[model samples]
Target chain A: MDDGISHNNNNNQILCPIKPIRCIVKLGGAAITCKNEIEKMNEESLEKVSSQLRQAMISGLSSVKICGMDWSKRPGNSEASPTVDDFSDQSLLDSDRFIVVHGAGSFGHFQASKSGVHKGGLNQPLVKAGFVATRISVTTLNLEIVRALAREGIPSIGMSPFSCGWLTCERNVASADVSMVAKAIDSGFVPVLHGDAVLDEAQDCTILSGDVIIRHLAAQLKPEYVVFLITVAAHDTTGGMVTKIWEAAMIAKLGIDVYIVKAATDDSLRALRGELKGNNVPEEWLGTVIRLLR
Target chain B: MDDGISHNNNNNQILCPIKPIRCIVKLGGAAITCKNEIEKMNEESLEKVSSQLRQAMISGLSSVKICGMDWSKRPGNSEASPTVDDFSDQSLLDSDRFIVVHGAGSFGHFQASKSGVHKGGLNQPLVKAGFVATRISVTTLNLEIVRALAREGIPSIGMSPFSCGWLTCERNVASADVSMVAKAIDSGFVPVLHGDAVLDEAQDCTILSGDVIIRHLAAQLKPEYVVFLITVAAHDTTGGMVTKIWEAAMIAKLGIDVYIVKAATDDSLRALRGELKGNNVPEEWLGTVIRLLR
Candidate 1:
C-alpha cells in the first residue's frame, strides 16, 4: 500500500540507496524583488545569490536546478534587449551541474496582455498575438542567457517547448517530450527552459508555467530535493504570494519533500544552507527523489 | 646613391610575394570626414566605396584593407565608448586575404586633447584630461573593434603603441619594432593598428599617423605597387596636381612604382562591373610599384 513511496530493499531498480539529492530550485520573482526591492535590481544581491548557489554546487550536491521569472525591465511592446549584465545571475547558476527554467514576467506579460492573448481566462484568440510575442521574447531572452552561460564556461543549451512541439491552450502546457530534458542532463549540459506558450492539440495553445514544469519533472524523476528560491519567504504576501502558497501546497501534497527557500536573504537563504547540511527531508522522499546519478 | 633602400632579389629573401596580398587597408580619418565637412560622413557613399574595394579584390587585385574610420560618423573621440558599427566598413574589407588597420580618431583625439599629451599641439589643461581619457578610450575602442571583427568571422589582433613600447614625440613615432607588423602580415593574419600618441624618446610623446606608417612600410618592402586611397585627389593647394604624393613620392624616389587614387565615387560605384581596371597613373610608375603577386 506504500505505492512505491517508501524505501524497500527489493526495489533494487532505484539507482542509489542513499539517493543523491538532485534539486530543482525555483527562485520566485517575489523573492528577488523582496531582497533587492522591486524598485531597482541590485548587483550585490545577485552576486550574493550566485555565491550561495556556487557553494551548494561545490559541496558535491548531485545537481542543482535554478529557475526564475524573467524580470528584465524592457517594455514588452517592442523587442526586449537584455544587457550582458542581465545574465550576471549565471555566476552562481554556472557553479554546479544545473538546469535553469525562467518565467516571462516583465519581458512578455505586457505585450501578451496588450495583444489580447492570455486574457479573459479563455483560449480563443484567432491571431495568437500573445503567443507570438511570448515566443519572441523567450527566444531573445534564452539567447542572451545562453551567451552569458557560455561566457562563464558553462555548457548550456536552450530548449523551447515550441521547438519540442509541446502544445498548449491558454496558459497551460498540455504535453512535452521531456526526453530532451533528460538527454541534456545525461550529457552533463545545463538545459535552459522558460515559461512559454505553445500550440497544443488538445487545448489549442497554452502557457507553461516554470513551477508546473518543475513539479512534473519531479514527479517523474523524483529528485532528492525541490528548492523554491522565490523572491519572498513562504509566508510573504507582498505580491504573487497567493500563487506561491498554492504551488507549495500542491508540491507538499504530491508527497515530494519540498523546501520553499528565498534566494540571497538573511533568513531563508541561511535556512536553505542549514537544510542541506542537516539532511532533514524524510528518508522515503530522499530515497525516491534524490539520485546521485550525475 | 640609392643607399637608403635595400632590395635583395634572392628568392629566399623574398617574404612570400606570391603568397596572396594580405594588404591591411588603413583608411585615414580625413577620408571619413573629407576634412572640410565632418557632418558629411555618408553611409551610402561609403557603401559604394566599400563595393568598389570588394570588386577590386574579387578581380584578383590582391586583398583590400580598410580602416574603421571609413565607416564612422565622426573621427573617433579618445574619451567615448567605441561602437560596433563603427567598423561596418570591414564587412567589405573581409575576404580570405584582406587585412585591416583602423584609426582611433575621436576616441584617441579626445584623450590626447584632454590629457594635454598633445602629440600635435600643446594644450596643458586639455592634455591632462586627454591622457587618462585617451588611455581608457583607446583600450575600450580596440576591444570593441576586435570583438566586432571576430563576430564577423575575421580574427583581428590589436596592438597598441603604448603596450608595444612604441612612443611618439611631436607628431612622430619616435621608435617602434616593425617586426610585429611584419609578422602579422607574413603569417596571413590581420594586424590592426590605430593612430596613437606614445611617450617619445626625444620629445616626450608624439602623434603617429597611419599614413606615416604606410610610408615607412613602402620604403621597407618595396612592394610592386603602393596605392593610397585618400579622400581627395593628389593635388596641392596651389592648383598644382601632385602626380607624385608624399608616400608616392618616397616610393617613386626609391625606384618603386606608386599610385595615389581616390575611392570610387557614387557614379563609378554604380558602373562597377568587377573588372580589373588600372589606375590612370603611367605604366612605368605602376610597374615600379610592388604588384600583388597573387
Candidate 2:
C-alpha cells in the first residue's frame, strides 16, 4: 500500500515523500493527567491501542513516537516549568523506534521561581535547588516509565536533556545533543525527551516546550506524519481563543504539517482506527515548511 | 515464613510435619470431559493455585504428580459422565515439581466399546477409528494443557501413555515404562500421563484407570501423601462405593498411607491447599498401615 514513498520503474532509488510523515503521537499532558480524561485507560482500552499500533507497525509504518506532557494547575504561560511526576505510564515513551519527550510543569516551575531563576533571562544566576529538583523529577518519571514498559514486555532506556550537556536558560533550550536521539531511534528503542530548562551559553538556562522538542525531532527524522492528540479541539470555541491562535502560529512556524485534532477517549473507538474527521494537515504543506537537509 | 517444616536443632536432618508425599493425583475421566470447568480458568485463580504449589515446593516437599483420565463417553453414558472439564492452569502445574497423566474419557470410550475392545480387550479386532480417535483426543488435550502452561510462564513438555509403551490386555494395563515418569520428576519438570488401554501379555490389552497408574506410581515413589482431586468426591457415596473401598484397601496393602480427599472444582487453589475436606485419610492411620507392610 501507500507507504508515502514513490518508486521509479526505471531505477531502484525509492523517492520518499517530502516531509514523509513518521507518526509522532504527542499525548497532551491533560489527556493523561486529568482524572476524568484518563479514567478510560483500562485494560481493554490499552489492549485496543496496542492492537491498533501493532496493525500500523505491520502495515510497514516505520515507527510511532508517543509523548506526554506534565500538567499543572498553572496555565497560559510558557515560562511555567513542568515536572515528570504529573504523568503516568511514562514508559510508553521508551521504544527504539520511538522518541518520547515530556514537559516539566510540576517538577521545576515553582522551584525555579523560588530560586529567582525565572526573574532574569538565561543570563540569570543558576538556582541549585531548582536544578536539582528538575533532575530528580526527570529521573523519577523516567524510572517509573521504564519499569512499566518492562512489565508490558517492552525494553526501554531513558535520557535526560540535562545529562546531554545542553545549556538551559529561563524557558528556552539551546545546543542539545540531538544526534543521541537519532542514534537511539536507529538502535530500535524509543528515546524519551521532555521539556526542561537547559543550560545555555548566551543565557544561563531556558525552558523548552514539548512542542518545540517535537519540532526539532520532526526536522531530524522527516517523519511521514506527526499526529498531536491535543486536549483542545483545532478550533478553540472556548474563551481561550487568543492562546489557541498563538499556539497554532508557533507550531506553523516550525514548517511541519500539523494536525490539530481533539484528543479521543476510549469510547470513541473510531479515532483509534485513524478515521478522525474534524481536521486534516496536508503532507505537501508540512513539506514546504520543514526543510530537512539530510 | 513457617514452611510446614520443623527442624530439630540437635540433628540438622530436616523434620517436616508432612513427610515428602509422593502421591499421584489421578484426575477422573469425567472431570476433563466437563465443559463448564474449563471455561472457569483465569489468571487470578491460576495464580492462587500456582502460588500455593510454589509454597509447597519451597517447604521442601517433593514429587507431586497430576494425572488426567481419558474418559470419552459411550453414547448412552454421556448423561452419567462428569460435567466439569480440566480447570488446572498448565502454567501452575509447570511450576510445581509434579507429573501429569490424563485420561481419554471422551476420546474413544464409546467407539472402543463398539469395536469390542472394551469388552474383549484392546486387540487387532478393535476398529481403528476408535483407536485413532482415542489417540487424537489424548494428544489434543495434552497439547492444550502444554500451551496453557506456557502462557502462564511455566515450561511444560508432553508425554503420551501410548507412545511410552503402556501395554494392556483384557482391559488390564499389565506393564508400562514408568521410568519416563521418574525421569521427568528427576529433571524438575512435571511429567504428564493419562489413563488408556495398554498392551497386556496375558489379557491381550486392557483399559487402565488413572487411579491404577497412580497406584503404580505410589509404589515406586513411596511419597508422604497421595491426594486425588476428582470431579465427584472420592467414591460416589451411593453406587461406586466399591471403587473407593478397593482404592483404600489396595493403597493400604501397598504399605503406604492413603488419603482419599475430595477435591472441589479442580481449581488449583483448593487442591494445593488441601481445603476440600469431605474426607481425609490422616497421616496417623497411614503410618500404621505402612507399618503393616513389614
| Model 2: CAPRI class | incorrect
Model 2 Cα lDDT, one tens digit per residue, B120-233 = 332232222233334334444454444333333233345555444455544455445444344334333455566654434564444565666676666655554555544443
DockQ of each: 0.01, 0.01
| C-alpha lDDT (0 to 100) for residue B15 of candidate 1 | 32
Task: Kindly list the per-residue Cα lDDT of model 1 for residues B70-124, writing each as its tens digit.
Answer: 1111224342322333333333332334444444433455435433455432223
Model 2, position A188, has a per-residue lDDT of: 39
Give model 1's TM-score for chain A to 2 decimal places: 0.62
Off by over 4 Å in 1: A1-21, A30-44, A60-97, A119-127, A143-155, A169-172, A233-239, A266-294, B1-294
In the range A1-294, model 2's lDDT, one tens digit per residue, is 122122222112222322233455454443323223211222332333334433333243335322212111112434332222322223233232544454442333333444443333322212322333333343343433433332232323345554433343334443344544453344333455555544443444445556656665554465544555445424321123354334434444455444444444432223323333224323332211222122
Quote the positional error of residue A134 for candidate 1 in Å.
2.0
Instruction: Mark the regions of model 2 whose C-alpha exceeds 4 Å error after superposition.
Output: A1-294, B1-21, B35-96, B120-126, B233-241, B265-294
On a 0 to 100 scale, what is the lDDT of residue A223 in model 2?
51
